[model samples]
Target: MSENRLREDLCFWAKSLFDRGLTGGASGNISVRTEDGGLLVTPTGVSMGRLDPARLSRFDAGGRLISGDPPTKEMPLHAAFYETRQSAGAVVHLHSTHSVALSILPDTDPDNAIPPLTAYAVMRVGKVALLPFYVPGDAAMAEAIRGLAGRRASVLLANHGPVVAAKDLEAAVFAMEELEETAKLALILRGTGARPLEAGQIAQVVRKFEVDWD
Candidate 1:
């Protein structure tokens, strides 16, 4: 798609996320790869609900800022995904409530933070790594993700929220939503003896959907 269209789409979806309460109060960032191998990122401290397409931060393939406002402090996190995941066309990070709550819970799996509570979660988010918390906007968060070596596309930052990378902007947003919802499910079912998809069922979904569950 054209750069203009991508900008519009980015703003549209960012607003959708904010309006739906998936993110709030400038607590999320979105970035998409441009056709020229650059990036158009949401501006620093801008509410996703109120993004202006023309004001999005633009960066060259070499990672130099080309125009628009300064990028978010979380740029390192986004950059790590693009450098590590060859298929990543977009990256989204959100301070959604449920996912953050899940991250704080004791004994949450670091390898797969959210269980296979639903097929959509399995198909969209795969295994979500739960990383230890870092101070918000800390470069160390990026280093932790880089340590994953791109083996996972979704991660929950402990005491913070979730980040997801996908083939494009829309896929990234959808996967992030799936992660949030699955986290909600997990939280709601805690100590309720809720039965998650069994090992075989999860395997079948992963195999059928070709999920990047590693």
Candidate 2:
């Protein structure tokens, strides 16, 4: 896609997330990798629901801001994916309610944030790491992501939100929705002794499904 079109698509995706109540106000950020290795990102302090395509921040492959206004304050969060995940083409962060709520539960796994209760979650997100909480926009948040490196594609920031990396903006958004859905399912099943998909079953789906949103 041309740089211009990529910007438009990202804005549309961002707005869709906001419209669907995935993220409210200006509480989320998204970025897409351009064909030339640069990035088109939503600007800091802008509402995801009303991002202007022409005003999206542009960053060269080397991480230099090349055009438009400055990028989101969570640049380090986005940069961690591009730097660690070889196939990541986009990164999305959202303050979706269920995912954040799940992250705070005392029983939530410190290593695996979401249970493999559904194949779609496993396919779209692989493993959602439960990262320790840090103040939003704090540099430590980025360092926490960096700690995960290549092992996971999505992470739930404890007491905060979920961040997902995908092959493109659309895939990133889709995966994030799945993350929230899985979280909601988990919440609804709590204390019911819900028979989650067995580990062997999850492995089978992982091997059989060609979910290449890497």
Candidate 3:
């Protein structure tokens, strides 16, 4: 996509997420890789609901800020994914309620936070790693993500929220939404012995969808 269109789509999806309460009050950040190997990122201290396309941060492949406003402090977080995952075209991080709540639960699996409650989650998000909590905007959070070795498309930051990487901005947003919704489902089914997809069923979905189920 053209740089102009990428900027517009970034704002469009950011606003949609904010409007639906997926993120609020400057609690989310998004970045997409450009054709020239640069990145278009949301500006720091800006609410997702109010992002201006022309004002988005632009960074070259070497990580220097080239133009527009300063990028979010969570640049390290976005950087980790792009650096580690060759397939990543976009990265999204959000402080959504349900995913954050799920991250806080004592029994939430660190290796796979979101269960196979829905096939879409399984296909889009694959395994959702749960990382230990770190202070907001800390570089340690990015290090934790780096530890995943690019194996996971989605991760739940303990006490924070979800971060997702995908092939494009739209796919990242859609995968993030699926992850949050599955987290909501997991929370709702907590302690009810809710039957998740059987191992065989999960395998079928993984195989049929060619999911990155590592």
Q: Which candidate leads in lDDT?
A: 1
TM-score of 2: 0.96
Per-candidate clash tally: 0, 0, 0
Q: Candidate 1: where is the Cα deviation over 4 Å?
A: none
TM-score to native of every candidate shown: 0.98, 0.96, 0.98
lDDT of 1 by residue, 79-145 (tens): 9999999999999999999999989989999999999999999999999999998998899999999
Shift of residue 207 alpha carbon in model 2, Å: 0.7
Candidate 3 wrongly placed segments (more than 4 Å): none
Candidate 1 Cα deviation (angstroms), residue 45: 0.9
Locate the minimum summed-lDDT window of 10 residues in model 3: 112-121
Worst 10 residues of 1 by lDDT: 205-214
Question: What pairs collide in candidate 3?
Answer: none
Ranking by lDDT: 1, 3, 2
Whole-model lDDT per candidate: 0.94, 0.89, 0.93
- RMSD versus native structure for model 1: 0.8
Residues 1-214, model 2: lDDT tens digits = 8887898889889999999999998899998999888888889999999998989999998889999988899998999888888899999999999999999999998777788888888898888889888887889888877887677889999998999999888889899999999999999999999988887878788889865322
